[model samples]
Target: MNAITQINPGIRQQILDAFNFRHATKIFDPDRKISDEDFNVILEAARLSPTSFGHEPFRILMIQSPEKRELFREFSWGANGMMNGSSGQLGTASHFGIILAATDELMRAGSDYLQDHYARVKQLPDEVIEIFNGAYGKFQAEDHKITSGREITDWSGKQAYIVLANMMTAGALMGIDSCPIEGFDMARTTQVLAEDFGIDTAKWKPAVMFAFGHRAKDPEFLKTRRTMQDTVSWF
Candidate 1:
């Protein structure tokens, strides 16, 4: 039996219930703001999420101003090419988070960020750190040869999604609603951030976003999902 089955039945049930209670919230109650303490817990969940090579390549951008949220909403509809009209959810959300992936500078070998990440965060010894540096250097070299660093964003974006999942689940456990938003014009997003917010997109690429708040209405209770037999197999 796996470790999941070994978990106490009550705790296992609670875990499953948390997942069941979470959904891509369609509409958020604008008046209902998330408490700073509870939101900090959600951010902590993202910080503690696992990432490839322990790189911790994602940066979180918290959208606080109504004007900025409105700007994003307009960009989503006009230039971002969102078809489902879900991007407007950002306008109604009490909390918004954008995950940005790190650039080549931070991921490079022997960089101060990587050095500190290993020595301080992971507490690796010098020998292990040296090994990691060599391995990561080789891996990054191969990555650049394969895609000229274009794939860096994709690679880091995958890690950000892991963070996104953790944050959403953490929020759900705290009775907060969340939606993972992907349908937005990335070029326009980068442009707006640079022109308006003074964020240099050359250094950090926006990967994904999440909106959090109280649900405006009871989300449609549909538990439809692919059966385990269809999606998984036993050897």
Candidate 2:
């Protein structure tokens, strides 16, 4: 690889521009489709995102079948309709995704899943794995006090959001629109996944969902935020 020397002048502005261009697009142009190439890039961005301990204890389910999307209408209040009566993200977006975080059984300090992950995926030696697991056990038991199954799952779920953010930003940089959704009944959605999608709820639970496509129209309001001085602090 060639060594890099100087930074591009407008690189920072370009990144900020992508953030400004992105919005919670509620409606998408059904007629427009995201190319397989571009969508794969978004998925790759998600694949490369960092997770706590490199565990990557999350999986993404892409919902593309019309039948599946139609089924979501019954549970996903956030994606069922637009305020203006147009079809919402589920009905019109070119792609939809459900991010599933691994359950507590797979994430506990010395669980079988973590053991295999350390030895195989992370390529760590047996001695190193033992040391790492000891530190992780303490982190869970004392530092974070993650005792209950619910607490463990919630911790894993937070890592899924990191991947979700990367995928959305990648799409925005490519001029694709996206919306992050959390407006579904968790119990109902979980039941639906188990019954219709053949997902094992015992091992994985849905953390969040998203929709992606070309926006049907521009948002009416400009993006707003607090001033940088008000939002950040220098130590």
Candidate 3:
């Protein structure tokens, strides 16, 4: 099945209920960790999130090893602002970091990447984000205007958040807790992974990361939620 297709409504309430139960965990139990299978379930959840087109839009880097996770913990400088750190005795790193990156390597000059771009665009039907991003790509090539690398990274990075939300929600349904981390030095991270992983820096840019593990205690506060009508109303 296409990853982006919305699930049927027979169990929509159950799914939304799962969402209601979800929250941004301030800490996870470092002594305990998620099973490999459950981790894959969350990865699949991310894979199933919607994208601008059929392009899938990003790659998943699951860093579970202690060394790697520690490296991220040390280098992750800017991701905490989004942590919503209302309160905490001590932060946990159970889920460690799951890196969601846009794979623009396929986005470069002639290769299967360009072909996949066209193919996905053809499948977009009436999607607005697709329409806009597709046109933007064309404009980039023809107008020959150079958008800063950070600009392109930021633009694509937004999509990763969508994937992050879905994964957290789905993980919550499985009785897992998550911390959506935006407090990290992404460029520096690219350097660390590049040296060891043999990954080319340009092909992938870090969009976001999440730490998942069992919640150690109650969150300090119930996160505020906006009603549907308040969040959306007819003009």
Candidate 2 deviant stretches above 4 angstroms:
1-6, 82-84
- For all the candidates, what are their Cα RMSDs to the real structure? 3.2, 2.8, 6.8
Which candidate number would show the highest TM-score if scored against the true structure? 2
TM-score of each: 0.86, 0.95, 0.71
Shift in Å, residue 190, candidate 2: 0.2
Task: Name the candidate that leads on lDDT.
Answer: 2
**Scored by CA lDDT, what does every candidate get?**
0.81, 0.93, 0.65
How would you encode candidate 2's per-residue C-alpha lDDT over 3-121 as one tens digit per residue? Answer: 98887869877789999999999999999999999999999999999998889989999999998888778778888884557668888999998999999989999999999999999
Worst lDDT run of 10 residues, candidate 2, spans 81-90
Any idea how many clashes model 1 has? 1
Colliding pairs, model 2: none
Ranking by lDDT: 2, 1, 3
